[model samples]
Every structure is written in structure tokens, then in C-alpha cells.
Target chain A: MTYVTDVPEMAVAPAGGPPGHGAVPAADTPTQWAAAYFDGYSTVGLLAVVGVLFLTVAFVGGRLLRPVVPTPEKLLTYECGVDPVGEGWAHTQVRYYVYAFLYVIFAVDSIFLFPWATVFAEPGFGGTTLVEMFVFLGFLTVGLLYAWKKGVLEWT
Target chain B: MNDTLEVALRLLAVFVIFLVLPLVIGQTEHKVMAHMQGRLGPMYAGGFHGWAQLVADGVKFAQKEDVVPANADRRVFQLAPAVALLPYLLVLVAIPIGPDNAVGEAIDAGIFFVLAVMGVGVLGSLMAGWASANKFSLLGGLRTAAQLLAYELPMLLTAASVAMAAGTVSLPGMLDAFEWWWVPWQIVGGVVFFVAGLAELQRPPFDAPVADSEIIFGAYTEYTGLRFALFLLAEYAGIVVLSGLTAVLFLGGWHGPFADELGWLWTLLKTLALAFVVIWLRATYPRLREDQLQKLAWTVLIPLALAQIALTGVVKVAIS
Candidate 1:
């Protein structure tokens, strides 16, 4: 999957290891050309090879190691250690999840407002920044206050 | 050399990323979620704690039994899971993950556009449920639609406040200023947006569509093999996309403690940390009531989002 060497004349290094080229640096080196995990060839065309290397490594590693053992028991629907009885896919408490889901929707909206106000001092950007952020936060707040008064945030 | 070639090459790089990065992050999400819940997720997979879980999962899915219900609509059933997944995968194309101006904007309305398009994921879930030829699954899909439609509005509103404040929709430029992040004035708004994203991602406490206890895996009940894999991909991909958006819009995009050389790594680390939070929420919280979920969205989240927007406006007007 390492496409870098797969381009044209470039030879690819094996997965998890870089190309066969030594770790030699060019003349005007900036200290060192560090190879943290793996290093690839220095050719321009092989740059995207990192992606190929990445795919190959991930796929191979996953296939060779992850066990595929599935007994009749292992295939049962998760029952928290209870002996499996009916089909695992039976309908149960979806509405409860829906409630939590709705809450999550509202809660996520609240995470954005603070940072919007923090960047207000970039030269002539303060006033413009404030107006835009507020307009944005406006819709968010309305949604929240509505939910709150409606007693949605209150846990039973 | 030529613009088209460069762009094409870049797009190719992006395609490779579509494969490699998601595989890495998606597996990490599973590992993190597993650990947070006091379980070892992939401990036996790839020598080191199931590092190969996702890859194995992908392969297994590709080869495992591909079952479609005899009564199901084959074309739509197949397409639904893809629908759930494709938009999230496609949206990653325009995302500048490295922080700063490393990647220029492909579309000017980056935040707005992504937020709007992201909503399409619900449709896939909806279609999956409907096409499954199962009552439980269809209901589950509708639940997702209801949950999302309600929440997307506030999510947009919260993002709207930031886009409004930035004065431009270019995410990288907003981070280039790199002064104040979006976490302060609208802490409330940030919280809401994050919660909405959690719901959208179908994480715990809000995992209605696939609620095993209720709908027997709900909309995905009829799916097996590759289609189920696509749904899983969409789930993890959605998490990554939301994490990236959170980092960009609220946490200062690419602005880390060192916004110079380590900017790109810092942005990824931050987004990675946020993804951990999503996993954390799954570990810590219990599911809520259905009525409460909707009430929270329409009554609580939307109003708060609107108020934050209004207050932001008033404060700006007064100061200026």
C-alpha cells in the first residue's frame, strides 16, 4: 500500500521500515533528518508513499494478528453475562436513548461561544468579531433557554 | 507544475488520507472507548492492545456473510449505509487539519457549509431503517432524524455565532489571528455544540438508532458484513470530522502553545484529545429519557444557542 515507491522508478521500503537508503543527510543539513518511526526515500515522487506504507502496515498488522475465532457462544448478542436466550437484536429502550440524544444536541451547541469571544483584539477586528459571534451565539442561547424553561435540562 | 496537476496530486494525497488516517483514528477511538469503560478494547489484536482491531474488522466485514433480508429493498438498503458515511468522508476534503494556512480554503463558507452538509448523515440512518423491512429498524431511523433535525439547528446557531464573529468563513485565517479562542464568551454555546455533535455521532447516552436494548441494533438490524462496516466507518468518521471542527472553530484551530513549528501536530493532538472526550462521555454518562432529549434540544439547546447569539450581538453593539 505504500504508494511512494510504487510511483515510477522508486523502490519502496517494507512496511514499518523505511526505504533501504541509509540515514544519510544532505550537505546543508538542519541538525538531522529525523526518522521517528520509519523513514522513506528522499525522492519527490515518493512523498505520498507514506500513505501507502500506512495502509499496508495497518491492513497487514490487523489481518495477521486479530483472532477470528468465533464459537457459537461468542456470536451471541451481548447480555451482560446472562445466558443468552432470545435474539440479540430485540427492541428495548430506544426512547431513553433518544432523550439523551436530544440533550446531547443542545449540550454540544454550548461548547462554541467562549472561543468566539476570545479573539476580539486582532487590530480592527474587535467590533466585527463581536457582532458576528453574538449573532451566531444568539440562535444557540435561544435554543438553550427554551430547553431550560421547558425543563428539558432537568434530570428526573 | 500546472495548477490542475498540483490540485490533482493534492486530491490524490487526500484520497490516501481517506484510507490511512481514518483507519488509524477509528481504531484509536475504539481503543479509547474500551479503556475508559474499564475494559481492554483491542488488547489481543495486533500485539499491542488491539491496535489492529479496526483493520481486522474491515477485512472481516469485507469477507464475512453479506446478508440482505429477503423482503428488503436491495438497492436503497445498500445505499443507505453509504449515505450515512459518504458525506462525512467527503467533508474531510476541505478540512485543514494541519492548522494555520497549510491548506487554503476550497469553499469560502467552510463552517456553515460543513455544518449544513453534515446533517445529511441522518438521512442515511433514516434510509437504512426504512429499507431494512423491519419495524424496529424503521422506527430507529426515524428517531435519528427527529433527534438530528432538532439538534442540527442549535448546532448551526452556535457555529453561526463564531462564523459571525470571525467576520469571514475562512477557518485558517481565523486561526492565523490566533488570539482568543471560541471557548470563553460562549462557553455555554461550545458545550451545546459539543453535545449536539455527540448525539450526531450516536455515542452512548444518545445512541438511540442502534440502541441494542430497544431496537435490536435499530436501523442497522438487517445489515451485516460490509454494509454494517460502512455504518461503523460513518460512526468513527463522523467523530473525527466533529473533532476537527471543534478544534478549528472553538479550540483555536491550529493555535497551540507553540503556534509556529509544531502547529500541525498540536492541532492533531488537540483534536485527538477531543475525540478522547467523546469516548469519555460514552464511559461516564447514562442514557436520558426520550421526552427529555427532545425538550433539551428544542427548549434548552436552541434557546441557549439563540441567547448566546443575541448576547454576543448586544455586547458587541454596546462596546462598539
Candidate 2:
């Protein structure tokens, strides 16, 4: 799963253990890479499946062991013992969504930084990528600054 | 057949850790929080310092009725616990405890995968909030969405800084690349990462989303019995993952005396030590106001994380 070697060969090799002692050698060809990619992800998928199974088993075991007695009062939405008031879906502050929108844009943009970071220090790529990233980040900063100036970042 | 057996054993090991570590953290919190507050917490439940308090709690939760609110969206409300609990388990699979691929599954883009999966975890609370059909639940849900969004950037940015510094995205690769000097070099990013990760998990100080005084457990207000317990367990599991990550990314995980033979011990000790700090913070600080929480994330953590990234780049270039 190591991508250290996957990056174009650097003059100073990236900080990976010698082959067989460190990271599993990344596949060379595209086909092998994809296979290796999914091979790893399949375990993640399996874990997710196992997680769901574990929870389901716990819940079922609870159901089998627990008592079931549902009173209307017991099932009511708890509001610190107050009887239900207006609808549960109350209108929340619109300000939250504004920040959420800002986050979405910035988050999507930052995703590019991950891969860039992996390759940023490779000898030949160092200067070029560093300048390129700051340039990219400069644009992101402008957007953040614009939002800041617009008072959109204000939480009130 | 041998390979399958090895995989099975590894999966089993991960499963055991996923189940057990949270309980360990949970019990530790019970006592640590008690001692910090000058009380002896849970001294009776399991005999020796209430060691089995969490086990007792699990039994108590199981025997209790699984209550779903009458006004709730039944299926989503019921499903929310699983959604919240599973991502941490998925993450536990990828965190390397020692060198030589000591991980449940080593994804190529390990850091990216971890951050992405953890980001998905917030949806569990959002879903719980929405489906519970309670006003407080909705508010809590909305707060979670906003806080998670606010902090996610710093978390990602800081992680990217580490990945950049290490020159790889794999967790083991990061550990393999870890130099003791990184403890000093990446300290700022490490703090920001841990703080932001805490905010992401909605742990105290950042736990406005579930403030019991204001929202009555927020997204979990309507949950009862085993369902509520699952949410609590998810939180402890989150603490373990976050601490483990902080250990690997900054603390030079498994890089102590006699590291080769005793690497896993070092990693575990570091993680537990950080987890203790987490509990200490909860005992020491009151919850922050919602606005204050957002302001800190947007104004402070994000900028610090960005600067850390730039610093890492400059330093890497200088030495290279």
C-alpha cells in the first residue's frame, strides 16, 4: 500500500524501509496497481461489513435478552418531562449552512493537497511543487479572506 | 488455506482491539474523571477499582428496553448507532501499531482514506438528529454538521502536513519515516490535529452538540438501552483512534528504547498517555460556547494548520 515508490524516482529516496522490511512494494503497472488498490480496499469493506454484523449481533442479543414493554408516554420524545410542543423540525439558524457551504468548497479544494504533499518533497519536484502549492493555497486564502471580509465567517 | 488462516487471525485481532480498547478507555475515564474531581468513581462494580464497570454497564444496557421515540423516523433512528460506530472500527483496521505492516489492512492512500472515512462518521449524528424528530435533536444535529465542517479542514490540513513531512500517506510509512526531531518539528500540527480531532468527535470542550444541559444529549436524546450505549461506545472508540493517530503522526510511535522488539508496547503506552490527556481536558475545561467553538476552528486551527504545512514544505526543501 506504500506509494513512496509509486512517486517518480527521487534522487534521495523517500522515507520508506528497504523492500521486504518496509512498505509492501507498490505495483509497477497500472493493472497491478488497480488490483493492489482494490485488494487493500476490500479489507476496509470487509471491516465495515464486520462492524455492521457486530452491531447487529449486539442489538439482536439485546433484543433476545431484554424485555419489551412500550408505553405511549415512555415512547414520547423526551423534552425534560415537558409535554410535546410545536413540530420537532424547528427552523434552525441559516448561518450554519453558510459556513457549511464555505467548508464544502475549501474541503474539496484541500483534497488536492494530499497527493501533492506526498510528492512535494521529491528532489526534482520540490521547488516546482512548493511554488505550485502556495499558489493554489494563495487562491484558497483569497476565498477565505473574501469570506472573512464579507462577515460570512462570523458565527453570530 | 494458510493465508486465509493468517488473515482470519489478523481480522480477529483487530476485532478484539476494536471491542476491547473502547471499554478500556471508558473505564479509565470513569476513574480518571472521578479522581480528578476528588471522587472515587465506580469502586463497587467490578471489585478491584470497578474494573468491570463498563462490562456491568453493557449488561445493564442490554437488559433495558430499546426505546424508539414515537415521533421518530424509526428505521433511520435505529440505524444511526451502527453508522456512528462502524467508521471507527474501519479506521482501527488501518492504524499501524508497529513496523513491517502491523495493521489490519494497509490502504495505499491510508491518511486520505482515514480522513475521508472519519468525515463520513459525522453523518451518523446528523442522521440521528434528523430522524429523532425532536427540536433539540435537530439543533444538536445542525451544530454537529457545522462544528464538524468547521474543524474538518484543520484536521485534514494538519494531516496533510504530516503526510507531506513523511513523504508518504501510509500510516506505517509515516511511522517508518518518523524521526525523533519530528516531535519538535510537528508539535504545532500535532496539537491542532488532536484538538480538531476532539472537536470532530464532539468530545467535551467541543461537545456543544450533545450538551446535556442544553439539548438533553442532542442527537441521542431519544435513544435508549443498547442504542444509547452504542453511541457512547463509538465515542470512546473515537478517542482511541484519535489518540493512536496523534501518537503515530507526532509522537514517533513505537520509536522508543528497544523499539524493534517492543514497538507495539511503546505505541500502546503513547496512545493511553494521550487518552489520559483527553480525559484530563474533559475534567479541567467547561464546554465552549457554540460561537466560540466555531471561531476557534475557523480563525485559529485552520490558519495554524496551513502555516504548519508551509513550514513543513520550506524545511523539507531546505534540507533536501
Name the regions of candidate 1 deviating beyond 4 angstroms. A1-156, B318-320
Docking class of 1: incorrect
User: What TM-score describes the B chain of model 2?
Assistant: 0.99
Give the poorly placed runs of model 2, Cα more than 4 Å off: A1-27
Writing each residue's lDDT as its tens digit, candidate 2 over B52-119 gives 99999999999999989888999999999988988898888888887677777767788988888887
Assess each model's interface with DockQ, reporting 2 decimals per model: 0.06, 0.50
Per-prediction count of colliding residue pairs? 96, 0
Give residue B45's lDDT in candidate 2 (0 to 100).
82
Model 1 alpha-carbon miss at residue B52, Å: 1.2
Model 1 whole-model lDDT (C-alpha atoms)? 0.63
Candidate 2 CAPRI-style tier: medium
Weakest 10 consecutive residues of candidate 1 chain B by summed lDDT:
B100-109
The TM-scores, chain A only, for the candidates as listed are: 0.39, 0.75
